[model samples]
Target: MSTQQPENTAPADRKVILVTGASSGIGAAIAARLVTEGHLVVAGARRTDRLRELATSTTEEAARSGGALEPVRLDVTDRADVAAFVQGARDRHGRVDVLINNAGVMPLSRLDSLLVDEWDRMIDVNVRGLLHGIAAALPVFTAQGSGHLVTVASIGAHEVVPTAAVYCGTKYAAWAITEGLRQEVDPSIRVTTISPGVVDSELAHTITEAGAAEAMRSYRAHAMGPDAIAAAVSYALAQPADIDVNEIVVRPARQR
Candidate 1:
């Protein structure tokens, strides 16, 4: 994996934050917002080219905010890769303050359509991916006695819709896992789940089913920008240590 250091060191109050699947959409927005907030953000994704583009786009703002954006090649589906990603940040920064498990895939299709491969793909990237993040970061957070784990889930966690049974199952799993972790972990380690609805993102593009794709086009017609979800993340992270923002659901006004 390729890694690049920032031009300037982070300020005293800056945090070392790790964001997975940060090449575009909600993950990219979160990484950019955190960097602008004076955080040393380690942005990782399978798309190294897009990661580099994100870093370049945020360079001036990061520099001005006493923050930095480091692009790293990463695949959340690989357990060893996630472990290395977390360890590499700890090795460089001495401590990792936060981890945003924003990696996910949504290929909406009905069960009868039997797109088994796409279903498995969702399970791999959505369910196992989240578990891998927890496995990699929980130990670090436990040892540090102070850390934050944020899961970018979906509004599907709360409701099921046509062509989204599998996707909603995966998201529900993400929400349950995050909630379970919150209950199990100590108070020193904060946990949060951000569920977004009908946001403009590349997730719909993954749908291989023609019917599902057509439906999503209409569903996303009134979608909000990815930055709105990023703002929710920022709000959760900005709260005082005593306050643990458990769950937040964000959706477009027109999205019922």
Candidate 2:
């Protein structure tokens, strides 16, 4: 193995990373941390204003670390947009080393509440969105013979609780899909599923069920910050090429 650098190639350690749902919460934190670690981060989200602010902050810090951030307006539910986003990164950076499928929704409610729209939103964003990401990135990863797919699932994937039936179903589907991809793909292309527990994030804000919203308020009392999940993503990405960390579950110490 040679430690030689090619004349027209980026440093081996510098990776072109693409992250979805990056306007805030875990996605934003992941983008920031990746930039801090000297990786070029392409962040995608639906909120242009928040993405603009993140770009400004990332730019300021990038000036110090020589890393960069490219913010793009994205709606994960839009399959074409997701493909275009990944294509744009590949065009700009020559290759995308990693894709973080982090865009998700959590509109929890009891089945009796019959929030059918909310259920649709969760299915669209959490399940279909993840599939879109994989559809967009898998080809590129295969073409390059190497790439990483990191999914931000939830502890809901592993357990069922009151008021989270549909949300849990989505997470479970996400986990199963990610694991299935891992098992089916070439080993050189890594797949990692990160399941976080009770993180302090904007996900709770989307809950429409009055009772569920109130329950989340109490549930989030000791939740960990989004940065904790971001760190877990970093840990998975920093591993050697041959070492694939298949799954990670991160939770606050106080969470049951």
Highest lDDT against the true fold, candidate? 1
Clashing pairs in 2: none
For residues 1-256, could you state the per-residue lDDT of candidate 1 as single tens digits? Answer: 6556545655676889999999999999999999999999999999999999999999888877888899999999999999999999999989999999999999999899999999999999999999999999999999999999999999999999999999999999999999999999999999999999998989998998999999999999999999999999999998898899999999998987
lDDT of 2 by residue, 1-256 (tens): 9956333322359899999999999999999988877789999999989988998987656765667888899999999999999999999889999999999999899999999999999999999999999999999999999999999999999999999999999999999999999999999999999999998889999998899999999999999999999999999999999999999999998897
TM-score of each: 0.96, 0.95
Evaluated at residue 233, the lDDT of candidate 2 is: 99
Q: Give candidate 2 regions above 4 Å deviation.
A: 1-12
What local lDDT does model 2 show for residue 41?
94
Instruction: State the local distance difference test value for candidate 1.
Output: 0.94
Q: lDDT, candidate 1, residue 204?
A: 90
